[model samples]
Target: MSEEEFRESGGRNTVFIGRQKPVMSYVLTTLTCLNNSPDVILKARGAAISLAVDVAQITIHRFAPGLRVADIKLGTEQLQSEEGGTRNVSSIEIRLTYPPEGQGEAAKA
Candidate 1:
């Protein structure tokens, strides 16, 4: 969800709700398909969590080096069925936060 949408959800200041919100809600939007059997889990070498989590975590790390293990939050994970539907797979949707406002532009530098 967009930041605007998230803030509109509820509450007064529209500021983030928790200490973890800054890191947990950051996201890079993309769609990818897993080419393996739905039963197989994605693996990342030399990283924490499962391979799937590593995949997402590493991507975030490429941008946000300060990302702590505790900062990661797994949302929803699913497999695309042969019928073009989604099955709830073991893989998860990972979210990472972008740095504060001005840093967004700097991150691209």
Candidate 2:
């Protein structure tokens, strides 16, 4: 990716945060980011984690022909709730990669 394309993203694994939006919206965004970078990451918490997986699947299977899931990390985050109490929220990170020529599938990490 160019310096100015996604400056704040810092290149390589550009990140996309999941939310209440439709799955296709995220799918398109990941595809667009992949156009410039070699890898992309989709992150989500709580109920949105499932939507993140759907977005990754749609983008890898139906959209980008050669894209593959490279890695996946799951954990929990503690955050202060609106009522002032702490909460543990489940989170996930799906790293999607477009392997170099002749390195597909075998290059998964």
lDDT tens string, model 1, 7-94?
A: 3543321122222323333223111221121112222112223544534555446644533332333433454568998765331323
lDDT of 2: 0.77
Off by over 4 Å in 2: 1-13, 105-109
RMSD of 2: 6.4
lDDT of 1 at 42: 25
Clashing pairs in 2: none
- Model 2 over residues 1-109: C-alpha lDDT tens digits? 2223323544455555657577888887888888888889887778888888898889878988788889998987777778999888887788999877878765564
TM-score of 1: 0.25
Error of 2 at 38 (Å): 0.9
Cα-based TM-score, every candidate: 0.25, 0.79
Query: Which candidate number maximizes TM-score?
Result: 2
